[model samples]
Target: MPTFPAQPSPANKSIALCVLFPVFFLAILVSHFTLLRLPYFWDEGGYYVPAALDFFRTGTLIPQSTVTNAHPPLPTIVMAGWWKIFGFHILATRVLVCLFAAAALLAVFRLTRTLLGEKAAWVATLLTAIYPVWFAQSTLAHADIFAAAFTLWAIALYLEPSEDRPQLKVAALFSLAALSKETAIVTPLALAIYELSLALRASRNRAVPKIPATKHLKSFAALSAPVLPLLTWYGYHRFKTGFIFGNPEFLRYNATANLSAYRIFLCLYHRIVHLTLHMNMFVAVACAIAAILMPAIAPRARLSHPVVTAISVILAANLLEFSILGGALLTRYLLPMYPLVILICVAIWQSHMARLQWFWLAGLTAVAFLAGIWINPPYAFAPEDNLTYRDMIVVHQQAIDFLQAHYPEATVLTAWPAAAEISRPDLGYTTHPYKFVAIENFSLIQIQRAASDPSGYDTALLFATKWAPPQNALSLSRHNSANDAKYFDFHLDLLPNEAAAILHGEVVWKTSRGGEWAAILHFPRIVDARLNPPR
Candidate 1:
């Protein structure tokens, strides 16, 4: 195994952490300044913000407004507590999430510095901070960033020198991570299994002499400790909700429905692509792969054997666990893993390239990542993956504004999250709630169904619910009536004009940006004076 510089002194480490965190937070806040007060987008409006609002208003762990997903309450608790102090504003919510992102970056820096060196740490942390998913997620009130921060801290502690390692602290951090997001339990669980394997190997082979087999057993015990709290959360959830995981639909969508063998296989392929290629991650991955073919120029540039083994275990476990679990193959679910991937890539670059060459390579990788934040890929993806989410919010806000200004009394037919946006002022879309008739989406079939009852609503709000890039590769391969409806929750949305024609309405206002679009339709209807008389 190769070695790097000595770890920084305790005082120096403290100073560095203090400096790095604010710098990271400032960078994130400045980058997201325009987005800070924008209305919640997609799942934020659909679930997280509502769940947190329920807690803020009622002091309940289980959300009353949204369908309870049995996600742990740490994010809701934090958001509610922050709202208590800051008075429940979108800017406050976004700033709190940005703090979590900065903490995660600080953990990344510490972990990389300990394992490699300061220079590698700087490069890895910078890359992670600007990586499209991390950048986009930084200001979003989602549990993933909360979980990623604690999980990275736990991993950093776990990777510390054995003499300085704090087993209880690591277990506590892992528990906090699991509390932040249930799926985050997978990390400590994976590590526990790794420790158990090591203990078994150590007991069987006497040649392995550094730490006793008993120490590995102790490590396993610490890692397994997080499971207890997670189970307690589920038990409490069952007691309250009569369900262990979540409501039936939540369980079926996230777990049971995802159990098919073919779907798991397909998901594994997508997971691999998500980790290696999504959002221009392929640039760094490709650079690292090419560097692997070259001779080592710096003996101290490699990660220690144990560090490599631990990272491999984590990567494999998360890849397989997430492949078999999540209904949506969201990149944000694997947030902590990106920093590790980038660290390894940086280490590989340091090992083979000259200083100037490594600088150029890192610079190119950063440029690619920055470009990815603005450029939509030519495939189907969640708009939340990049700045496209801002477009979604802007266009939706425009449509809602049109409705507010011109047809405030019209019952607007629309789909979530527009449904949620127009109905919830707390989400930052409107001052007063609008009367909305909700549908699943603006798909042709759904619109046709809504058209059947024209008397129910006088206006329609429509949007592109899914990204359908021209010549979308994934759409070509994966989109079929059965598979899309069953697996992807996907449908082809009618254009605003087509939808209005079917609904016997005219398009009143519409807007489009970055392949995302939203429109409002107005229907003329006779008013019954006796039923709805002027005041």
Candidate 2:
């Protein structure tokens, strides 16, 4: 391994952290200012916000209002604590998540500075902050940001070169990461395997026999220590919920149903795209690939061999693991890896390009990332991947506002997150809960089922559940019955007018933005005082 610079003094490190954190926090808050007050979107409304509210209201780790997914309680605990101090508000929740994003950026800065230098650190951190997925996630109350923050800090500690490395601190951070989200255990587990491989290789060598192998063995043990806490969490969850992973449906969706070899292969391809090309990340990565072919202008800017190997192992492990694990190929799941990718690309640019060339490349890449935040790709993707999520929330809020203004007492028919939005005031959609009938989604079959009993609800609030762009090639090819049955059950949502016809209602109000849309349908019926009178 190449000799790395000495670690910063404790006092200096503290000062840098203090200065960088507020700067990063303020930048993130300003960038996400408009979105900070918006109601929770998608999974935030569906699961995370509800779970945190349950913990905040009742002090129960297992959410009473929402089905327990057996996710670790750290995020819930943190959010509940924030609510206690700040007094439960959407702004407070978003600000807290921004703090986590800032912390993650600080860790990225420190990691890149240690691996390359200060200049490289600045470029890497700046790019990571503006990356569409990371920027969008900054204000969203999700476990991924919390876990990414802790995981990046832990990786920084692990990679920092010192005579006596802080193995225990690394393990503790890894444990905290896992406690934030169970999937975060993958990082430490990946590192542990990497350490074991190093130990095995050292053992095979006669020159450095026992000492190097024993050192690596110790590192492996420490890295693996995070598993105990994670297992303990699972044990407690099983004791409480009678399931180790989660509800059967959660287990089936995230794990069991994803075990098919073909699906895994498909997911692997998608994962590659997510890591290398999603949200214009290809701009930086492609530049790095081209730069690699050029002669080094500053060979000293290259990362040490061990550092590159470790980062590569981390990226590869996450790529393969997430492909086999997550049901939905959400980009947010790979949050930590984006920083590593950026760090490598920035380092390569610093190594090969002249100062002017490096400046232009980084500038162009930043512009691309910023553009990605507003521009939707020509494929199906989670709205949360970019500002499309904000568009989604805005449209929903408008529909809800219209519903409240005209028919506050009417029973509203909608799918979750809208159902959750209208029913839960704490989710920031309304001051009071509305009567709502929930369906799975806005698909034709689901709408038909709702149509079977139009008397159940007086108003129908329909929205685009899946983000299918007009030129979505994936949607065109993926609409087949075989694909639907084997993979995701892809279904086209009925247009507001079409759905209204089926439900014997008229579209009263509708709005759309950035390919997402929402509408309210009203059904009129005569009420006979003799049969059903007002109380």
Residue lDDT tens for model 2, 1-535:
1123443334334346678889999999998888889888878888888898998898888888988889999999999999999999889999999999999999999998777767777889999999999989999998999999999999999988775688899999999999998888888888899889888888898895534777788889999999999999899999988999989999999999999998898788878999999889999999999988999974455777778888888888898998899777788989999999998899889889888898799999999999999997766778999999999899999998998899989899998889889988888887779998999888788888998987878999999988876753444334443654367655678899999988999999999998999999999988776866679
Considering only N, C-alpha and C atoms within 3 Å, which residue pairs clash in candidate 1? Answer: none
What is each predicted model's overall lDDT from 0 to 1? Answer: 0.86, 0.86
Worst 10 residues of 2 by lDDT: 1-10
Listed in order, each prediction's TM-score against the native is 0.94, 0.94
Task: Pull out the clashing pairs in model 2.
Answer: none
lDDT of 1: 0.86
* TM-score: model 1 vs. ground truth: 0.94
Worst 10 residues of 1 by lDDT: 1-10
Instruction: Give candidate 2's error at residue 367 in angstroms.
Output: 0.7
